[model samples]
Target: MNITALKPFKITWAVLLCTFFSALAHAQENLYIPLETQHNALVLSVSNSHDLNIAYYGKRLNSDKEYSSVLRQYNQTGDYSQVLDAAYTSAGSRNLMEPAISVIHADGNTSLSLKYISHKVEDLDENISQASIKLEDTAYGFNVSLYYKLYKKEDVIEQWSELSHNEKGPVELTKFASGNLYFRDAQYYLTQYHGDWAHEMNPETSLLTHGIKTIDSKLGTRANLFQPSVFMVAMDQPATEDEGTVLFGAMEWSGNFKIDLELDYRDNLRLIAGMNNYASSYKLEKGEIFETPKFLHLLSHNGKGEASRKLHSWAKDYKLLDGNGERLTLLNNWEATYFDFEEKKLFELLKDTKELGVDLFLLDDGWFGNKYPRNNDDAGLGDWQANKRKLPNGVSSLVKEAGENGVKFGIWIEPEMVNPESELYHEHPEWVIKQPKRKEHYFRNQLVLDLSNPKVQDFVFNVVNDLFLENPELAYIKWDCNAVIYNAYSSHLDKQSHLYIDYVKGLYNVLERIRKKYPKVPMMLCSGGGGRVDYAALEYFTEFWPSDNTDPLERIFMQWEYSYFYPAISVANHVTEWGKQPLKFRVDVAMMGKLGFDIVVGELEQKDLQFVQHAVKTYDDIKQIVWQGDLYRLSDPKNTDFASLMYVNEEKDQAVVFNYLVNNRYGQGSKRPVKLGGLDPEKRYRIQEINLYPGTSSYIDSNQVYSGDFLMKIGFNPKVGKGKESVLLKVEAVR
Candidate 1:
């Protein structure tokens, strides 16, 4: 029991800073509390001298060093903190109706995880001599700002509030070298940047690119708020220039590329969204005010795109296809290529993905606008040509009719929104991103393209390299973004430089000038969906689209939190059997990763397209052991026993287990007995049963069994398969 002797009772925050500024002189008239702690959670910094800087922390979802350093599981008989405190006390008919858990702690060495509980603050203002607290459970949030500066300075917030609604606009800013911040709303954009904008060597390849970019010349005062929202508080960045100031509360993690919402008092917004780690809860409401929405991926701008399962044809011999290497699995057509797709619905979805073997054929977004006819997200975002009334033989006759159906065609672009009734913003009204006098502010109505003026990056690089010089085969290019950047300013910099780190180095110089002119077109990085899967956009787009809520019992905790820091070969996993169960639990949770198929296979029902052709042939036979193996994390996701386990080996004689029992309680014993791990003791092992949740029968074995005689005679019930059940395992030592 040495793991910090079962931690949780460590409240040693004796800062008494004059009794926390004498209880903030009875705080209320525009407050400032600022408690703090990092490493074991506890933060609360509320400052609303007016411009808002709300901060509340302490969110749990399994603590105790994440149950002894990541699910080695310790103990907690399970029941989701009494079913999430009875679903927030049955949300007492909605909105702050007096829930409970004002605070709770977990301590150490692991086990006793209701995941997270305690983070509800709502102080509107006044009463502060000073304050700061520090409790523990780790992960924290809340920081609403209007102003603070005892002098930390990132560029003295020149006009903020991206969107807290009721009209407070100034939208126009872009910067990013790390001094992060952004603003733009006509073509949709809002900012705080930090979804893999790395630069250890020009990192950002595109996951809706952002790390900072806020520019403002003057578009001031405009906030009807629609798709624009950001409150993201936590601040610190001061270091020197005297270094002796106070006012603090910081906790930064950012990886699941931005998504955090709770609001529900006629404000209706629920999406918690995250791929892995990050999202315990931060819910801020009080006098509730949020506004930031100016065209953030509501589709249109030729729609928007990103979908991938793998598209197997060896994906162009493994570079993942496009430009003659030949390793694809493609078949996209975003929701079946929306409203009208002649050419025989793209040859009946590329002839059943070339007889279930697939090769390539994407066509998301609407295919450009012609006065907008069902172009989604409101209007006709900056038309990029090619919709002479929906393909009247253009786009090179649909890439020479999808290369005569042998497949290999792609298209979808956002080019950073611009449709305030576009014609390129009516002939470049100084390329948008306003703020000289103030007035121009529109979110799903569009306007945000000032790539730091190199003539608006050569007019969006000659309308996206003239659509690859008129369809030179097209290949693949998704590249989309939705929005963020709460009124930043930029009219070619200087007014004291820093346009949110030069709009994140002008979005890595527009993806390094489109990889020096499409060095073989292959981009993907979409936002709005998967919010921008990160890792500095995987050094320039190879894959990512990890979430749009894939739902396979909720993608087993979103692919176990995107495999704790990406690399299931960059992920693209599709197989979306349109929610609410079945389709083999959405192709066994999209065959774990890197696969693809978003439906429409001759309109399913041939036994759900033969269970998606055996879940894409068991995702092409264990996709090289789930892309180069080695993961091990087994069970305990704040477990109320929706049981879970994970394995994928390669060394110690190849393993491949993946148990999950979910929804237990019938005699509370669905048959236990599971230990098994690393093999090859005295050799002799064959066993080849792939999936056995509820048992279908396919067991074989050489059976030598060593390693503590198979960890005391292997057994596995696991639970949570409420949709019947499943247990998939596969071994193969053989020495």
Candidate 2:
């Protein structure tokens, strides 16, 4: 928590300093609670009953009147709705306004009062600032503390709430949101990402109507595709790719969670987000405290791109992904040899793998326990041992050989599942999650292990730990979980257990053990594909496999939206046969993220193979800028015939642009200049072509100098040839 990294450094709000200082000087008053960053401010005032109400929460506060209290000034008299509103609008109570908390005491009562206990400035670091408000209901022996921190440098407010009890008995909570937020107006466009399985993290936006729009996940495993934990609300109309006022929020929990935006009768917006109430009610004993997952909130007058930058900056600064990363170029054996592997075949693939300049080799599924034999999806899961029949030489031998050949080794594992045919499952039938007296359900011919139990957690951890200890050369692990919770009941927990949250906790605990032991090894999270990519899982894994669908055209849309909240280096992109090479579109798409190859290189023709080598060389040349630079989404794939993306370094000294036309268009010979952003306006840049594959045309003349302003504002048109085509260009600032 280096508070300094959270706040922005620019000084646009300096003119309002006098008024802000005057208002802040009086913020010590019992009736006023204010938190301000360099440009944004949140003001709240205590009501007569001691509950805090929202005054303002947007751009910098220039006057006390800007956040004038409505509840404190208005004198309510007649109407029942208005009367009810005046009487029951507290954040900790269950009435008109949404309650941030709802806890049940020993007597089974859910109502409690949260009186203002105290407020203080937690940190005043020049880069970041934080404030805290503590509330307590001594009568019920319950207390809550809300924390707010602003990264003045990034324009982001990270917030969450903690609940604890002092009574001599256990207390249960039904609903505990991070915090309840109030907006002054109801007019907003709610933007959300909703998809299932292969189609994950798809962005969509709609106007907020007069009802509760909720995005939630009840599935035990982050509900990867069903309901994501991030959202944005823009005023008036939805923001374009690069413009408008928007408020964004994302809960950083990889478990069942909820996010709701309610427009009450009063035409104001009420937002509450945190752990989902779906099949979750955590019990807290006396002297124990529970913390809700953090929710990142950001306000941007400059549209989704800027708001997203704030998120990316915070995530990177916090090391949310433990990302010490320049993601490697590798080759995964899944598409090349799924459930099919031998020492010779692996060695044969290694030849092309080395020739293509891939530094890492990932052995996909099929090297495991003999009982199930990994013959297909039906067997060989719960067992972590190498299949003696498939690889008689052993995993250590493979690792040693790969290392000897100048390639690092990684393995794919689905540690959270068990096939009924597995030896472990046969020995411990009680380990699988199933109902007490009902038919067991299965997906991919497998059942989920009851991770909530310590025994199961230990079992999973030991399997991976043994592998790493035995083969010190193991460089990475692709951890995959491929099923949903069709039957989520845990055989190990009590009847009232919160299976959803507990399950994720158990999974996290297992991951923590492995991370502690193998701190340097990078892990990629996958669930079938892109299922568990979020900040929660990011804590343990360095990146994720964004999709099993490697169709580059579709990825133009998926990866485009995916980059909105994540860095390119955190996505595992593979070049499969489809979008096949040279056209080389597949490899070009894969190069946009953590590049890898999924198809067998041996099957390629000589010319295409040569093209593959050239493509890899080109990728290596531009990967630094592609993975580490700020991404500017030029044109969305879905809206038009072409999709364009640009990556620029922070100093704006260099950049790389990617352009693709999914389908060939007719009747047009005109060139269209692609304007780029985030450039040093006065500097001149030498633009050069970076394309290596055939069927592509050079977008710009090589070694041509142009002012950054001219390049960004009146840009160079792409030299796109006929038929589905793409081109890559590199720009370096020059004298």
Candidate 3:
């Protein structure tokens, strides 16, 4: 019998049946998948022969409408030979552009191709839905799953990727991105934030021409050189606040991250964002899985203002820890006393805290260390014990005293750093991150602890665990990381390339345990000011210190840019003694976020003290509106001499406006009309000026009523003075 010939005939019949079923399934099911929010949708199409592509990502389209035509339109343009607009691009094959995922297989093969396998959509809640698409390499024993979590109400989507391999040998992953997006526009304007230690969150806007623009950080610990977020405005005109199409993306990562914006030859803008592949190439062994950080993006046709509002809503609703909890007004004694305070000074501060109506009293940096006292920043960082010489009675006594005075107590600790002179460092010299036989580098007189070690992770976790264990009433914690990782070598890690990635994972593991142990405690994420301000870290923190530079003028610019993505509830704005601006101006600026005072409140004169008390009361009254409301940027500080912004509650019943005169100009007009937004036009609102000096008259009528339509259209023109003069207005809807 000629069985070989019969075997070929059987194989042909099997192939024919498989092709017939695939065609039948394609004809019966929709090829385009739409992940929709309230008003936006990200439609993905798997109609192509071997690729998954984004068909449309903008305003919501009717589900009954077919998107195959749109996919065909996109496919008709660009280079026909290459996969121009893919949902997730890979290296090799027909893709010549920057790949989202690049890998080297066991046989040193670099060529790879990913094809769609299947997908599923599930509702997480009434406001969030997740859609996951599975793709497999055509030739390799690997699979990649892409995820998009749609925040229905906020109109924001969170995207991430997971890679798993079942290959016999290890696979070297060179480039892996959390999310990839494509936009076809004539012009693209990119707005990103970049700054140094004290001058963080400085925003810059530039036109993206023909090449690639990358924003990244190689700092292993505090990735604050350039924040991993951007706003891309697509229009024929320049970027505007409330009138153009805007795409916003922010990476939820605390360690090294990179955001690449490339304008291809066909004027298509491609954005690839995820953990940085700078010096951290990861390896995946058989049966191992690697997941990228969450990348959040939103599409808005109403302009940057709407984009900012949606992101802020999403952050407060889901991303922030204890998103709806109260952020108490605090008085931190860092700038007031520095590392030179004793127990008596703290007692005095506690008295002032009660007198000034502050909710929490935070003792910053000088209270710890036993064998090596933390008298300064250069010593006793790793030792978490209270300094016996300074405290004499221990931190528990202080916590008790503060509680007796009707004020909560908090303390600061930089757990991820160690001083060479400390007992902990001397005992375990291998815990510090350093290359073998290399001279260790120091920043701010400290070295970063090698968190890649499990023992070190346990120690870091204990730094917080022991504090609450000793003083169960500890109301808050300020976790600070003072230095960036340098000489990035981990003694516990086998491969040097895994140092950065593993360090972040270890940090997160410790944080996760701490959060689980102390879930209700309010903790602030601080790193030499605004160094570690990212979404991933904020998930474990209640708030963040925006910057060490608390000068009101500098904070005006800093907080403005920060409000574009982060909510006001997460901003810890402090009124410090760093600027010559008036006390009222300083307090008003701080009141725009989470209000705090870092100055010597006991030294305030009678008049200033009264004003401080008045401002605190005013902030207490409107804090709910400020923290939980929708923010609208009325004026940009970059274009004008004054900055104005407002927050309106969800009910549209109450609102608060903050106006600051940044710089004075010669012969400038004394009064300017500021247009308001985010209001019900039919309702009548009663406006009153608060936080004014005793017996001082406002620029307008203190208590007046106006229709929302008039307020939005005609606006209110307030009488202004020189620079540093500010105004705070409270508006209430008339019942």
Candidate 4:
């Protein structure tokens, strides 16, 4: 044979095969998958090792540009043999960062190596599209599916993970985070919310170092000691409201949760967020699946302000229950009558409510109980029945009276707690969450019910169901949980470790049922105030009580911090009689969110009453803007003696600005120029001061019309005088 002639032909064929394989590998590496919204993109790609990595997460990129170089760079870290940029970091692998999922397999294997198997993209709706990536363990039957849903218009992305195994034995899940995110080399600053009972949602920013910083809640139920939300800014300098790259997210779980920010030795950062796996190790039997709560996040190139607006828009458009609905202005009798209220006292309060132009009349606590009257926090928590001593005619009569007075009726109930002296507790002691011999601890003289029990769940559901059934005219329900879970035991569950997860699931089950049955009715979630303020509960409830402390000054700081991740429509702010501040100041602060009065309205002087009436009417006119608008925090109270904020509607036609003199400075009576934001710069607007004292003139020239550019750039000065002084300005496009 002609060996030399055959060799050239063989070499030519081999070269063609090598070129084809090389192109195939290059194409696979360049297979960029993007979960994108209108302005943002969470782009992912598969590495040469078949590991999925977040290639880019920020402003949307040009569609024509190839992203293979970016993906290669992201996965090419020199420090470790394996890249630490896994889309969903799993433990028992080469990755040294905090793992998003950690488990002990049936084979007693603590390590897992997940390889990308498949992927799918589906359009859930006009505004939402979901991208899912499937992965499988290299040596086990375990499987995981990572999901990313892009809320297109809101520019927000929600991520979650689902895990399952086909092994014969049960798998122990030690840690299961909802989502994991990795950022390349950058100086990181974290803005997290933390505070105690009355001072919920206090924001504190700190520079991230070469270790893990954790924000978590051990409180079984409220989960408010530290909110499951954070903002991570990746920039060389400190974070600013309107500048830098900001990554913000919230864990949509009402139970105990944790968020960990791990800044690696190379200045890179990894974020792990989800259920707190403290004592709640979940066991997944064969063929069973576990799904983590949705961890919603968004990336903003324009800074934290844009991140907040995007989140608010997403919550209002999709996540929040009845997000588009207008929250009512109500008058609650908590501060007025408390547990001392009777039918007659409520009727008088209803009269005052009607006179003040309040939309709804909420009868707070003390209306329930039979033999052990709920006259105080010490008793009658489990009894949902009307108190024969306080309201002899039951809640139906109050509903009828409220209706007659031209106001809708609402009632407060703590269905998750039971007083030790109550009939329900006496009859079913096993229903309480307590260990067999461990001494039980009580908060507010009440114990938490074991919602992990189906029977207890039924009872709690019936408490709400029966109220609406008995009083068909019931307009609203304020669900309160006054006590945190103690003893950490569930008699109904075989695994005591499953108590926390099971309890939250049961509560969600009951809430889901109630919501499905009464989809239109408004429900407020109040867990000793701001305790249960999480996205998981907001799915079923309309609004939440931000805090028990309604002092106007304190709320200014609290609500400001809260606005970072939550929308104004979801915050139930009330004008209370806690501080010695003026009634106008209180009403103005309350008007910032959902307007409600908790003060004794009947005791108001004529001038104060007139001002109250004016404020209620004013809030109604601007409530839509406040609820559905973009919130721009013009001035942070934390840094200045004066705090200012503004809300501008989507159409750029209507806006409202609020200026508060938090404290009287040494230069009292000085004029402070406050700039406004979120308005159409080219449009001319007319300004008017509302909810003012009868004889007092406006601090700004209300008659003048100015362009939005002037208002935002040059600005106007509010006549500052005494501390606690505030002014509300209404801006309307001059047609």
Candidate 5:
């Protein structure tokens, strides 16, 4: 029973069996662990062509493991109660087909069905083939066994120098995320599920399988089930070049979604399962290994047609404005104002922002204070009142001046934290998050506002409500939080009951009240940058600050990762120079999302401003297309040499192409121009050049011959600028 030889087999099983086992493991109504070991060993066997066999060696791990069942009885509601059914719950007749855990004890061999759940996975590799075998080893300790079976025969390509591995470390098994398996063969790398439950399927069931957990977000407390998950691999067959895929859990718990890859190996390579985990006790049997090359062309790319159509559908149905009736392209004065600005400086920034075509102007933190400075997080966090010295005429005056500038005024607030020197902290020390009779160790010299209490929620909401009442012109709020709760405690909650959920609910209630009162002011979510960026937060705030790091190259991958489930319109990509560490990819990558300038641009040269102006104009032209059109990823993050392309088309005849030139450390620089597809075949597109980066332009084709399948093919260079660079091309159909 040596598990060491099983490493390669486990890798194969993880890719192929992840969807299969996850579905069945969570298929039962009780959400109970059937194994006797807290950590169980996972095994996968191909019973007979179509039927997959999955086995969990050690299911029940602890004496208190059965207590999880009691918790389920307490939490049971709606569809979750259906899992207890004796028969398998069918997915019914739909384009998506997913089968749950089919348990059979015949000859002591268990067989289950691999279920394909998400539209994203289906859309990503719709044209590619997939097969996997996943094994979870909980027998000795927690570990996973995976065996990847490549179904796609075409030239299979995978990258070796992936992002996380680039940094020097112990090669953490689950460094990218937790409760997941990370493996790399010559052709592909794999990441399995561990603790992340928000992206799991049938969350209630996933939660019951794994222990129930809580997550804090702008929406308050959400009970999420973090499950160990898996994905499938396939050779891409889209309009663009194909890359290997590692599909996993996203949004819902039961889907076969994948993060697309760009293959760079010159040699025609195919991925085979390998035993890379030697440190763990799991033993690998070389003879037990299996190899198969099958192409997954069915789930490949359908182009921008379906994606754009979906975006348009979401936009037409979703409201862009706040309940208070204010439209937003908000301008916050954090960079322009900071703590050094006076009322006069605020006016200057507001006036300039108004002229720059911004709809809402927000005064970032540092506006409120008394003797203690509001310039930093150390002072006046919960002191929500105006500083008479700094704001002599009060916020009403500032709001009036902003109104006169033709822009609605907004303010920043962090209701969850309180400075020790602040009046609120002095008045009630019990309000901070702390254990009873224990000294409260502070972060940033501040304590977290305990949202578990209704009193705290009301008090926090009242502060913002008072500010809004005093200044009716205030139309937006930039809600900010510096950190997550390090020590979880709530005075109002029971000692035995988990207080995290209560804290989340209280936070949610406060926002609900604020939205009810000042429905007109849209709150832009900002949490120490993007620590709070998730689907839960997006449900409340109209937009989110994508990250604290706004460097374009970094943002391209970040935005790409986020775009898998979130809408592009909800992500705010501001143009901030931070410290002009120049990279060629800056402007183009920043414009891919909701566009705004975060840096102090008042001092740039006329040419630079002209570049900014042109970017803004181009943004306005393609805003709808980027926000509502379907997006197709063309480059691989693993291979920096390959270019990244995001194509948005409003009409079949019109398309906008965003090209990024990534720097490759090895080999000759990318020379091949990418060939594009999914365009109007009959109409000749008069390619209008809108160059954002420096590059020589030449049309590969002159005479517009009968535009048919050929229209699906257009080429662009893989590399353009030195180091990191990107290009923007908008193709228009000319009659």
Candidate 6:
């Protein structure tokens, strides 16, 4: 991947760090990288001992006056030997004493001197500006390039680094952080999300005391619980959805990741993010290059929603593939057939697809490899071939048959793992990640593929990438990683300690290759579920299967949390067999993103099938707005009895709202007025209430015209119904 092509953000100089290099000493030479945009300005500079500090970040400023006062009067600022805290920070050899970069020079020099070298500013596509500084310590024969980007439209600054060694010798990289930021405020608090597979993103907020608060994930596949492992540092006062200053950001990395926020004694705060130094170190040969994942930081004056909007917009610009028109409707055979998959039964599933408007048929986990028949999860991974028993006519035949029936074909594959009993695992026993003299553990009866090995990376890339060139009809793929990598050592890696770092890079390489090879096919990422969904993976994959739990109420929470960082189009929300629940609620909940189904359509009653058919058509009609519109998450499902979400397009001419309530209180038929959000407010709208429940009155008039101002104020009132129920409302601005 060419680093220059990555247009993260455009920058302006709020606190310009004089870009020219003067060959000053590492400790005395202060290098500042300034990125000033209309919404905000971010200035990162190197203080003493090559410590990169976020000198200023927040409101966009016009004055170039350097805020040197933020360095403090009593502190050494950039003077390494003068400040006592410098002993525990920058240029330190001890753990918890994080340095910008730790290198071992061939000259046997004890001190790693990163003296200032040079600087450059370049413009990228989309009006993005990039300012970079080159810092090389010839004593160690190593060079490090720090890059900062500012996007013209958003209040976000992106930071990343590239590390390489000179021709003189080799260097061992024990520790590397993409960037370290400093904020002088002691009152700032840290916020992060923590959860399991189904409960993927739960917000955890706490004040920062005089200590280090780290959110680290070693699960190996971005860890469903702590993704991007992204963290936010905000003032002690809580920021509301639309108000308050909050600095939110993340590292776009997939594998083991870590972010550390330290509050030193001088009342100054520091934040660092990079490859998790979890039993990992890299050896950079002469000319070998290692690029740290991009770290995106955004400060919102209008609050968390603004930050979310900024990140969502940028993610769309970089990752989101344009929705190929209306959102697609796909059918996965997992819930429908489990492992009892056979050609005859698969045809039965596809038979209902076209009639119900599901254009894509996904053959889930059972139709791969002969040695380890995928009847269960214990085997068959890493063997990427058609299972004759499951598809006697071959998988291609099934794809052809599906195409004949008017639906495209998709398949599920776990290429990043191997079953102990599978051929790939037995043939390449050294390919699995395992620590020295330690017991090996497994998740889902599988071990993670050691992508750190160049051969392993090539093999996995060829096997899966071949699946496409070999079968041109395969329109989409659900790439899944079902194992949590516990073993921190890869036998093929020369430096056993470099497993975590090298493995992630190798994974990215494979993904990058496959994406380049098959540029048109869409891919979705799932680790168990929601485990590997982050910006890094987003660069290759189009959608994220956030959870295995398809319950409508559960998704309302899961989707809401992830939408804070990702755009709605990237979330793969499905209407599965959510047991006895109203189809109304299921489809309504599924309306927020790319929708799919997990039910046995062949078994549904005619009425239910007709409902599915109707739901599919309804989705196709309004999906353009739903997938591309700005989302306003309203009401909480965890606390309130009701949950609601609103979607409005860029033109503000169209809108859709999903309002759900479970087990009506006393059957009071209480009418709760829901004023729509994100409308033009001044324009008049013609509202249409689409009622899903057959018997109960939708309570909404068939047709009513009202001004956007009136609708947002007085709102539409729907009579609450008995049992679990949901409603959908569509509004269109009129002349």
Q: How well does each candidate superpose onto the true structure, as a TM-score?
A: 0.31, 0.91, 0.94, 0.94, 0.60, 0.88
Q: What are the per-residue Cα lDDT tens digits for candidate 4 across 1-735? A: 889989989998787666545544654555578777898777787767787776677667777255555544443224452446678888978877788888999988899888899999999999889988999996888999998888898788888999999987999999998898877756887777777788887777788898999988888888775464555555555657788887777888988888888887667788888999999999999889899999888877787788899888888878789898878789999888778878898899999889989889999888888888887888888988888877788888889998899999998888999999899999999999988898878988988899999999999999989998999999999999878888888878899989999989999999988988898799898987888787878999889888888889899998887888889999999988888778888888998888888878778898998888988878888999999899998877777777889999989999988878777767544256778888899999988887788778775676789999998998766655684278888899999
Q: So what's the TM-score on candidate 5?
A: 0.60
Alpha-carbon runs more than 4 Å astray in model 1: 1-330, 333-345, 348-382, 387-390, 393-411, 417-426, 432-448, 451-489, 492-498, 501-531, 534-561, 565-571, 574-590, 593-612, 616-688, 691-735
Return the candidate ranking by lDDT, descending: 3, 4, 2, 6, 5, 1
lDDT of 2 by residue, 1-735 (tens): 776764554343453454344333333342766677767777766645565556567777676564654333322222222212211133334465555567788777767777677888756677788878888776786888888877887878878888898877788887888766777553889889888766777887888877788898877773766767878899767787689888988887887788878777656677888888777888888888788877888888888878776667777676456553566688888888888878778877766678778888898999898867987888889988888888888888878878778888888889888888899889988888877688878877888888889999999998888888899788889899887776678877884457887888888899888888887688888887777777877878778888788888777788888887787778888888765434467777787878888877888877778887888888888887876788888766777667778889878898988877765657332157777878898999987877565554554677678998997889777665554376777889995
lDDT of 6 by residue, 334-408 (tens): 888898878988888888778778889888888887988888888888888788888877778888889899999
Model 1 lDDT tens row, 1-735: 575753433322333333344334322332333322211111222222121112222222244332112111212222111221111111112224222112111121111111222233332233111121211122212112221111111111111111111112221111101111111111212122222211111101111222222211111111101211122221122111112111111111112122333323222122221111111122223233321111111101110000011111112222232312222456677766665565556667777776556557777776676765426655566777766666667677767766886777776777766766656766777666766677776654665776666777766667678888887778877776655443555677554234433344456577668777775566776654554443334346766665556656656665654453344555666776565665665666565656677578887767666656665666667666666554444453334344344344546566665655444456332345555543445544454546433324433333534443453256333333444444455666665
In terms of lDDT, the best-performing candidate is: 3
Worst 10-residue lDDT window for candidate 6 reads 14-23
Candidate 4 TM-score to native: 0.94
lDDT of 2: 0.76
Ten contiguous residues minimizing lDDT sum, candidate 1: 298-307
- In model 3, pairs of residues that clash are none
Candidates by TM-score, descending order: 3, 4, 2, 6, 5, 1
Give lDDT tens digits, candidate 5, residues 305-387. 23333332332233233311223565566666567778877777787676567676777888887866587778888888777
Candidate achieving higher lDDT, 2 or 3: 3
Model 4 Cα displacement at 520 (Å)? 1.1
Q: How high is the lDDT of residue 459 in model 6?
A: 93
